[model samples]
Target: MEFCDECGSMMKAGEGEDHWVCDSCGYEKGRDPEAEEAMETTQGQEVSEIIDTSDVEDKGLPTTTVHCPECGNDRAYWYMQQIRSADESETRFFVCTECEHKWREDDH
Candidate 1:
């Protein structure tokens, strides 16, 4: 992806495939063949298998006794993530061990 030099915004493809144009500032720059090659090389690479963490029995995550609303399971794995502003508390996430149900608890 190309960025505009004048407005510092992401540039879009120009009329042809050889250049990129910035819609915000009307700036244009020649597409770099090396950058394009690198992007293609990365994009063409084989993608690894995606593992569903919730279904996995062991994820090295801490366990809690929180109630699962979906399956009525008492055991679950819990983790915290900051889903709000920096000053706010981190949200607590839980995945049921039995039914693989995911839920979150926020400190709003």
Candidate 2:
């Protein structure tokens, strides 16, 4: 009888199937052919779509009067983005254009 690597539980052989199921932890093992094919296709597409960022524009949305904290330069650009949190609250990051420094800002 095979054993589970995670919880040290006994693993049962799946009848007429390629998977091995863990009786104690309910963990499933073995690859699904359809799911594997889908993942491969997604990875191939992502590899093809990867672009060089050096030649691309920053394209960050515009904001008002973002000053650099280090150099005190007021001619910096700003961008607003949604950051995920543990409590599911959104946080914003303000990036300075001149110095490329990032700072967290509260929603106003």
Candidate 3:
């Protein structure tokens, strides 16, 4: 997760994974062994229980009585996302249960 000092962009591993290089500004930095050990990610360090939901349709999402313009379905699964600024309201997304149509509603 090294960042480029020149352009403030994320850097990637260079040739042979010996150094980090910024693609945007062509900046390179040698990898430190001590820093690499400290920066080791904790991903996959522990195994968590995985629930299989292959038989579920909506993946346990809540449903609402939203109108689907594509298939005229009255029932749809809804979720909210912060697509706009933090001060503004979150955008409401709807997926029709019958026809799987997707749509979004914003507080304009």
Candidate 4:
């Protein structure tokens, strides 16, 4: 069994692939050589496609109704989708709906 880098969960090796998958955290690691190459190429392309959200209008973005659990700000709180994997890796951000305070949701 292998360990997920993100969540540190034990992963069982798949039958055909050399990769291991963590069932508890849904983390997949050790991709096939071809797949890894393709992913690398895709990542290079994505670097050029990064968008500046600061230029977007307030009305254009989807607002979530959750209050800032940290700041008690009710009027404008950013709702970020956190992707947590079995290896304990997570990516989350917060964009205050009212204050426009762009920050990582878990930074606090």
List clash counts for every candidate, in order.
0, 0, 0, 9
lDDT of every predicted structure (CA atoms): 0.77, 0.59, 0.76, 0.60
Could you tell me the TM-score of candidate 4?
0.32
For residue 105, give model 3's deviation from the true position in Å. 2.1
Candidate ordering by lDDT (highest first): 1, 3, 4, 2
Better TM-score candidate (3, 4): 3
Best by lDDT: 1
The C-alpha RMSD of each candidate to the native structure, in angstroms, is 6.8, 9.6, 9.3, 10.6
Task: Give per-model TM-scores.
Answer: 0.47, 0.35, 0.45, 0.32
For model 3, how does the per-residue alpha-carbon lDDT over 3-55 read when each residue is reduced to its tens digit? Answer: 99899999999999999999999999988878778775664623332223333
Off by over 4 Å in 4: 1-50, 66-72, 75-90
Candidate 3 deviation (Cα RMSD): 9.3
lDDT of 4 by residue, 13-65 (tens): 76677878888888887756675456533466446544455734553665565
Off by over 4 Å in 1: 40-64, 67-73, 82-108
Q: Evaluate model 2: give its TM-score.
A: 0.35
- Model 1 Cα lDDT, one tens digit per residue, 8-106: 999999887789999998999898888677764453322342235654566688888988889999998887766557798977888888888877764
Instruction: Please tell me which model should have the higher lDDT, number 1 or number 4.
Output: 1
lDDT by residue for model 2 over 49-73, one digit each (tens)? 4333231226644655766677776
